[model samples]
Target: MRAHKITLAALVVAAGLSLTACQNDGDDTAATTDPSSVATTSPSAGGAGSDGSDAASPEASSGGKDTTAGAGTGEQSTSGKCRTDGLKITAIDNFIDGDPQGTVAVEMKNTSGRDCVIAGFAGVDLKTNEGTLSAERKGEPGDPYVLKNGKTIAFSVTYPLNETGGTGVRITNLVVTPPNETKSVTLPWPGKPSLPVTDGSGEPVRVGPIGSAGQGG
Candidate 1:
């Protein structure tokens, strides 16, 4: 009877121990469990930002297109006009006071790099300290200039300078308006009127194609 009781006691103890171990294992699993909530809140890592940044874009994309044409490489040039590439109605050439009355041959260069269909005429206005002079059209019927890609066209016209005669004349504004883009070139004429080419005496300068001896009034 004593042996049987001891055996029964041992069996009970072993069963209790097994149950306890299982309970401890279940508690450990519950502790590690997560409450399903957080998802994609922030960026995982380095990703594209909202700020548009295409560092590897082609050069054409950087400079954009020049109307119908493409961007010119470093080898290309805009010629005499400071209007630069893709400029419209650019003042490529200018003759200051070739005539005593102050004649300025306005040379417009279309740096648009596009084939421009000739349309409205280009006007040249002479600005003085007094005020603005009437705009004059160059050539017959003020014919439109049909400039090809990277081409320059010059139109000569005369305008009156300031009443006060001198070598320097102030130009209030000089603009060339084309059918498409309008570009302007302006220089402050302070004392009187000075040409791109001046004399040693600092007199009125004369500029034009060779063989044209301009007379001053």
Candidate 2:
């Protein structure tokens, strides 16, 4: 009877071991098949951030393009008359053979920072140290003369030549007024020369609609 009991106990122990092995295999299979047990990386990780950055880059580039398109890159228009304060005036003395009068060129340079226009003739007066000697305006009105900074335009002034018999009028000051302006600028007469004293019956001593430099006055 005792031998029979020992055999039965050994059989029970062997069955318990087999059952435990089956339960462990089932637990491993359940762990492998369960979705929560799986080790999975998030879908929106480093690669997803890179893709999002690339998409945003194109959007940023598109936004910059729109901004550029809204703003223009053309030169603004700066057309206007040259002011008297902005003009740098000079005189060029020249002579011609057989002419009864001496000719002088009045050069006007734009000293301002922008572009401007000067049209028609300039008003000129030949004055002495004592008082005004002769006043003339001989500029012919014409097209607008657009002048840029550092650009020059000139017109000619004719003055009666000094004669030996004391007929000449000595000029000390040259007062010049640009067109469309009431203000005037005074400059020294070329060489402080003299002009023939004449009555107001003859042609004007000043002649021009102002022209570009080196061109006909």
Candidate 3:
């Protein structure tokens, strides 16, 4: 009877061990097959969705196309207005026939090798031994002139003839300043040494607005 009881106890212990092993195997299988666990281990987990919605988005690709569309046109990046340093200026005496008395044309040529703009009136001053005489501006300014490479623009200066034969101001040089520029260029007077004018007169010499090369006079 004692042997039989011992054998029965051993059988009960084996049965309990077998049941625990089965339960542990079932738990491991459930963990490996779970949907959440499979998704976290996938290679494309955070990338574009399974339908590729994020990869095909318009906002993602539009920026690259916009940046390269109009890069090489060059017209949008044109050089700005002309400056005195880029011009070749010359004074022409009596350039126009039948022009009003004592009129001289000053021409400014664009030597900048690029297109630029010139407008309004140029500042003109006659340099004499006594002092500098500023020219009075006449007429309203016209449209702005676009000076192409190697092209020219001009303006006219009208001075009193001093027909009275009295002693006149002797002009040694002409100081010319382009419109909107602070610098100036000095050139020798084109014609006579003396610019005859009535003394103590208010703004005897007059300057006109800029125009086409020969049209100013």
Global lDDT of each candidate: 0.44, 0.72, 0.77
- For candidate 3, give the lDDT: 0.77
Please report the candidate that would top TM-score against the real structure. 3
lDDT winner: 3
Evaluated at residue 80, the lDDT of candidate 1 is 28
Which regions of candidate 3 deviate over 4 angstroms?
1-77, 95-100, 197-199, 212-217
Superposed model 1: Cα runs more than 4 Å off: 1-85, 88-100, 142-145, 161-172, 179-217
Tell me which residue pairs clash in candidate 1: 100-216, 167-193, 168-192, 168-193, 168-194, 169-192, 169-193, 170-189
Query: Model 3: C-alpha RMSD to truth?
Result: 12.7
- Scored against the true structure, residue 214 in model 1 reaches a CA lDDT of 21
Q: List the candidates' TM-scores in order.
A: 0.35, 0.57, 0.61
RMSD of 1: 16.1
Comparing 1 with 2 on TM-score, the higher-scoring candidate is: 2
Can you tell me which runs of candidate 2 are displaced by over 4 Å? 1-77, 199-204, 212-217
Instruction: Kindly list the per-residue Cα lDDT of model 3 for residues 3-45, writing each as its tens digit.
Output: 9999999999999999999999999899877976778667464
Q: In lDDT terms, how accurate is model 2?
A: 0.72
Ranking by lDDT: 3, 2, 1
Model 1, backbone clash pairs (residues 3+ apart or across chains), number: 8
